[model samples]
Target chain A: MTTTSTAPLGDITGSEAALRGFLAGLPGVDQVGAEARAAMLASRSVKTSAKSYAVDLAISMIDLTTLEGADTAGKVRALAAKALRPDPSDPGCPSVAAVCVYPDLAGTARAALGNSTGHSRVQVASVATAFPSGRASLETKLRDTAEAVAAGADEIDMVIDRGAFLSGHEGRVLDEIVAVKQACRGPGAGRGGEVHLKVILETGELGTYDNVRRASWLAMLAGADFIKTSTGKVQPAATLPVTLVMLEAVRDFRAATGRQVGVKAAGGIRASKDAVRYLVMVNEVTGGDWLDPRWFRFGASGLLNDLLLQRQKLATGHYSGPDHVTLD
Target chain B: MTADRPGDRLTVRKTFKLYIGGAFPRSESGRSFVVRDAEGRFWANAAQASRKDARDAVVAARTAQPGWAARAPYLRGQVLYRVAEVLEGRKAQFAAEVGRGEGLAAPRAEEVVDAAIDRWVWYAGWADKVGQVLGGANPVAGPYFNLSTPEPTGVVAVVAPQESSLLGLVSVVAPVVATGNTVVVIASERVPLPAVTLAEVLATSDVPGGVVNLLTGRVAEIAPWLASHLDVDALDLTGAGGADSDEPTGQLAGELEAAAAENLKRVRRPPVVPEDWTADPGMDRLRWTLEIKTVWHPVGV
Candidate 1:
């Protein structure tokens, strides 16, 4: 079931008390069970035609990311072009879903994709709300999202304030996500349609599986169109168990509330095999409904090249080398 | 001696495992094959390394290459020399393995063992001196001073000579590592006992764990993966085209050389004829595993 439009998740965010109670009342994730299940699913092999199909799906679902301090406009433009034509040699290769960058580079990425949009072109996703570390004030964070949205960013990835959440101020975190979500609405409604809001939990810093689950529900309840695992700036980013917990949260959230939210696993997902494992996890955990690029994505840079390499290996019946793929 | 000892005690047999990252690990595939001496007597079980094992060894070698290459040439020399010393101490065991695995007479096996140890020492001596011989300053007409130095070419995948297990394995491996290149060596399929024994010596010596990874399996099964691996910088096809190889020579070597062409890997084609291990292995292999880097610096007033 694709989400045609965002619907508010009841009145859970009506007040600080309601939001806290709802998040706290939400079931605690079983750490051991989650980890064991994640490990077990990771062993499931998707091969041959299934592997080829999974590679294409994974490539199309990638939010080709470049969020480095050293990233220049030219670099973002090149990355955008690379995203559009992943394998320049293979015209049949599908473009990635989006090109993720900093707020300032959203226009560059959008322009680099040329005139194509919707069906033919890649979407531009920008990491806003003082990304990596959501340490800025609410005003600045909202400004960050608005600027990116104004810069032609079709999607806004905003990092949650882990400090506020971990410090027992869940309401403040919810308010901040709501503010960022509102800012994702661009200067006026329907100008370029609704800018998708991806709430990044930076789950690495969230501490435990239970916290990851709570954070997932909190973002979803606060109108997050997508719940992301990490900012790729912290250690232990986007672990399988954490992702499993997030995926379970989304499944339950969708069932409970009638609204479907996407899941994005970022950081440390490099190998094609790992990407396939994530795909398998998606298929098994949430069923085939979330298998589409609209529902699941990988926020990565090196992963695209690996998927390309594996795709080539499958096509050529021999192992391929890094030389065949472009360097990110 | 205890006359009352309960029957004869059961002698313990060492489980030969693949040496990777300085640790003995069974094949990731959890497969082991029976190893029989050349006389057709069952000897022991050697790990039947899979492509995954070969890939892991490449990762280990790639990880160790930088630190091993960055070591002072004198330090690398001392480490390799120490390997020779360790091999000398374990010569009896290695010679026994060689005698059985290669169907050689005890004396001939001992001679092969001696030659292998000597070859290691020879390469150890070259570790410090090879750089001086291979690198030097170039006279330039411009104001810039140009100098060239030979650097290790990262990870090397070596197929050890299938016939001459000990001497041939050492011959190919020593030259590659002598120039600071870390190697993932596929030992002779028919005679892998001595290669595993040499891995023991490498483990005990000051040589880093990943500097020399030994894999005991079919060259056809492992060499293709290593040759095409993006991380592996070179391939030595010595064992692929050996005289006693199970696969037809040139077929395997040709395939590997072509796969290596994907990344333009520095490949040393196998010898046209089976090599005489006792003969000196000249600078060919050392040069094969090294890249010449030239640098220019402005001459200051």
Candidate 2:
């Protein structure tokens, strides 16, 4: 005797049509040409919340590329020292979110950040999952994630297997993502040790807007706390158009699942204008709710100076020399 | 051009069948619908594609993807160029079809046809050069050599533009196939005769069987299936619904977005204003056709 299963098949899921209808009716799609211009003008005069704007103003210094010498740990300590010092006159100066370093130096950076003047405010982020290039086996990647978390890193930046994703082995990529996320989970919800997982799609690698959309969804479905643009090791690493695509993915995912995901535009983000554009994109696509530093971050080493310059220009009404403010 | 005489009779120069899996066949549902010209006269009876036709087109596109992607870029360029050549030869036929369907003057219709052919040639040149401009070496900090390159995403489903039938169809399909991704294009429901004729050109242009499958049907019926198709990696809503009608365009865009949510299909939202067929090609096509691939080898190597 054969047992017949009475489950629905194909695209007959109950909520499919409704969800499609909701997406089609989204405020952005319905409004034609004039709506975009009107929205832009409306945003210009609107006052952003000061507390939220402060977070948006926070920038994270990533020192992954500085781990070149044999004394990698010592270099991390020195970098942490520089990142933690306070500017006397500007005590109200907003602090950087974290100093991102390699996995090996996570502990050292954590200790330095813990003891520095701004110890309580700074976080220590570590790169894991055979980072910069995720060519390792799934088991190896998971081990790497667990090891980084064990080393006291607050956040883990991991790279996804672009090859597997491009080759349509989406299942394999998703599986690896789930396993690594499992590794990040602990005994207690918040106490077991909370580590955020930033899944880097490296948009530069996923060539088209469409592929970027697919990869972004895949990463989110697999449980990424944040979706990042690039590893900062590729050309076309971060661009307004590519970031716009990812932002749309994030927006759609949230609408579909009612889950909020973070976006990080990394790699070649060097100037303030680029950061502002990314901010605009996030605000426009995901709504104003995700504009804070907790939801949006710029992974850069050089952007601080430009942001400082722009901030000074806003404050003193005069351009200051690069020497006027020591970002280091 | 003929005079606008009150006694002039509407005549159909061609009737079209569904092009699926590199073969022309009647709709599985055996359905046909009469498409009328601007004068409210029936011009032709075109295939009323069924859900099965949509699936069949998906199958054809999926089957053709590997070979097409693996072909030399220059060879792909040549095949696309050949499509333009065939389209140029039948310029008058397409112009006449557009004239009746869109209510454009004869000269204006011919110009639209010429513009469509020119659009194909422009995309043909991009087949070889897009990769160089879009993908390249990355400067990694460690002792590892890394490079990023673009590759074709597999099978795409396109909802061709309703207003500019031939040009819109070519604009959507050329970019997709130019980058080695196979396509299943849903022709304009109001004007599908030209879409079927273009399929004939694709068949003879060495585009390979199944590379570009053309289906003539109601987009509302077929778009949801294509959008939600698990095997279909990307869906383009470039030309579906009337741009003038917010109700239908919004409804279609939302349905496609939600269906695409299942597999997270990449969706190119329809443009508010139809793209100019004769204008220089923008990054819109390249943005939709490519995927990023990051490669790593040991530092010293």
Candidate 3:
């Protein structure tokens, strides 16, 4: 038996009114099936060479994030340097995909990564759209997104207004996403102004697999480059089932429209094994297309250390600790 | 999937888990390794604690340190004595398990378990007097009363002996916790049953949760993590090079020592002399696990 992808996402809901019908008409998610599929994928054994490869790949996909209230420029610079060189003792550990921070610190992170040794491959990703809690107005969320993009963030992570999405307001969610995606253009829209937009559904608040599916389609149809699982602010931020639901959404979306979107399983994934499990799910659900940093990312802070530690163990036959890797 | 199917009585199996923060939790990594009997048969699947488990243990130990250290020394002694009392009651079980794990005769295993319980009793008595013995007033050429005393050094990581699974495990764990330091112990890999049973004794005793976290897995896999853990104040390398006695285990000990250097963890090496486990351990066991803090007060006219 073959698994069925979501219906071909051809601009059926291109209009505000038409999109609601399209979203409502889309197939509902079977929560048990999604959860069971995620659990089975998580149990997939990845060892030795495969583990080492997954470790490196997971490290590269990490958006080394620090969203604390006590964040300092010094802290952001240190973290950006860590993203550039995760393991100082071993030079071979690859640089992370990006350094995620609040919108205000985007430029500093960009500058720090730019000044890193050799040419820097790390991108500066900023959380915008009123961030963790999307309680603000559309004007406020747009300004936040525009500021992050203008401040040199290569990517913007925007949180949807759960208040609207939960209240059965799919059109409201779509409008916000479209506006944020437009704001991501950063003073130059379409004319080489390409700032990727990662729409954070904050699945923990969305509350169900069906909601997660709706949110994914809502974000995709409106022009999001990536569909992220959480904002790391709320409880139950990221889970296997939620990421699985999102991965399936992205997979089915790409199947429907020829445009490939990314999926990030962020928050609470602190260990190498957990991250590897997410990678396993990504492989089985999204296939090879979403395997790289461009198509998949981890929005985490402390997870990089474990990945580096495991990487060290694979290399030296002994596990490493915080002193050997970045504290973040 | 029973070995003997037709109308055979099934045996009850044991779940080997990690003792962390006073709770029995499986390793967060959910990884387990097959621990075998000395005869090379699958005995049980023991939790293979990952680096994250070591980190969580350090966190648990750190969180438990202040309160456990602040408890009255006499009361601390009582709690430790409680551990011994609990162990005494469960002696036969530990003896049987340790015997099976170490491939030892039942009589010798019983003797080892007895020694382990007695070691706890020894440390229990030392809890109250340790300060008076290790601390004293220092005379200086100043008009000030200066006193130096030994305080529990935060969290400690101990590797229990590979061969002396029970007695050696207790010997290292008892003194460290007796002086008020919380410990994260890695029991003998193939013989973690006894150590886990000890954790149970500790939980039911007055010992607080997070006071002693026990992990059963490869020292090579988890020891370096404990060594470099910033919150871990010291490391007992007593079980560093265990029964395997290979070149890699020695190099692992060296690597653990090197990793401990960054945090400046007071590293304890195995005894220079082959001392008997049954022999009474002097203050030497408790000495390195303490920190000497000196405070001075002005003499009033």
Candidate 4:
């Protein structure tokens, strides 16, 4: 079933009243059916060559991340190096799509990764707008996005003001996202590409699948290049059912506006099986359209090693362990 | 469904499944094997765990290792003693399963069941004392205070004894967990009913989930995967050779040991001769499943 609305989304974000009516009118998510469908898709086995392909695809799609308060330049560089060469032993292994880090460390990741951008190049993604907790002023949030963009972040991952959105002041939230998107268009730190803005709803704090759906639409309407699920800091982050609801929103968003936005399921996704399951859901739920790294992404740190290990096991006829892979 | 009921009463058969992550789950492969008694009668159908089940058990054991290891050693002992108490309560059912599965007399089965319960209590006592016995201050030439302590070696994959079943399984498992290591145990393929019952005992006891994941399947089929698994810290091949002479031969044990070398896993090879489970289990298993962590502090004042 498709989740598209008949009304055009060209001017939905022009006013707060129109934005709220559109999100409320778009569609309500079926929690049970969404969860059951996700669980059912999780059980579908993609084995042998299909599994091998999934592993490589998953490896390439990882936003190899490290966002601790104690993150160091050395740690970001090391993570960047791993992203550049995920499997040092096997040169044939694919490099991850990007290296995600805090805004202050974006330059460290960018410097370590060198001047690289676009589809195949390993981009640096930074979480800004007082990430994990978007309880910041609009001026500070804009400055946060601008600094990451100025520091050579190819992509800006901004968190929505969930407090404002939860209290029914979604116009303020939408205005913040649009402002951040504008900030992403500012000076490009010598990198010759548009800084993609990924809007994080932090679905865990949103409280329901209906809210998650509305948030996805709200983000997409406010010019989000990608709609993300979490900030990797909350419980119930990036769950399959929530991602399912978001995927439906993005799919229907494309149908309504003829502009396709990406979906990133970040936080708490660390296993190869779970990553592959997400890929399966993407395949079945949205067809093959969202299978590419440009359209879909996983914001995870430990997930890369597991994908590598699974890749190694497929190559060799034995099960691989964490010892065989680089520690993230 | 049976056609006739003895004494006009129907008996409900128990479903034997693999115990993983503190839950009873059927094998992911959806396969079950008909277990026969010593007299070759249909005993029950036991879940035939596949390689995937073994893999899942390793993941569960890995997840539970840190919390299981972080608990105070004394508290761990109490929890294990609690397991012994629970096992004691289920003694009759275990005795019946062990008797039929091992082809032993009812009295002998009861003895084996009793020995298994005592084994837990024995290891439970060792839990708190093991540190004092194994860890100590080391002599250092430098002006430093050096201390050595034994820590759990992470997830251990144990192949339980095929012939002895109850007592031998307890002998191998209790020691590994007693020292704080979580284990993914491959129960005796021929006789695994007692191991399932033991899993139930562990579930009811204070022993945390994922501490002891039991898989009932071919040891040879599952051992190589566990042996070669990078996440598994140690492997016990006690039942590498077992009840069925056709499976898990001595050569397979050597191959498993070789596979374990990939990650430098601590491997306890199968005994040259059948082991006496009733004999005192030396600190060998405990030591094998533990890593000595030495810390040095500068001597001041």
Top DockQ model: 4
How high is the lDDT of residue B295 in model 4? 100
- Per-residue accuracy of model 1 over A78-113 as CA lDDT, tens digit each: 998899999999999999999999999998998998
Candidate 1: clashing pairs of residues: none
Could you estimate the TM-score for every candidate? 0.91, 0.46, 0.78, 0.88
Candidate 2 CAPRI level: incorrect
* lDDT of each residue in B174-213, candidate 3, tens digit only: 8998999999999987678788888889889889999999
Show where candidate 4 strays beyond 4 Å.
A3-36, A117-119, A163-173, A205-214, A326-328, B1-9, B70-75, B128-151, B242-249, B280-286, B290-301
**How are the candidates ranked when ordered by DockQ, highest leading?**
4, 1, 3, 2
- The Cα error of candidate 1 at residue B171, in Å, is 0.9
True contacts kept of 4: 0.72
lDDT of candidate 3 at residue B157, scale 0 to 100: 93
Q: Which tens-of-lDDT digit does each residue in B44-136 have in candidate 1?
A: 999999988987798788889889999999999999999999999998999899999999999999999999999999999999988789998
Q: Candidates ranked by TM-score, best first?
A: 1, 4, 3, 2
Off by over 4 Å in 3: A1-11, A115-120, A188-192, B1-75, B88-119, B141-169, B182-197, B209-280, B291-301
True contacts kept of each: 0.39, 0.00, 0.11, 0.72
Report the lDDT tens digits of candidate 2 across residue range A85-139. Answer: 4233455546566778777887888788773433345767778898888999888
- Indicate the docking level reached by candidate 3: incorrect
Which stretches of model 2 miss by more than 4 angstroms? A1-328, B1-13, B241-249
lDDT of 2 by residue, B107-145 (tens): 998988888888889989889887887888888988877
True contacts kept of 3: 0.11
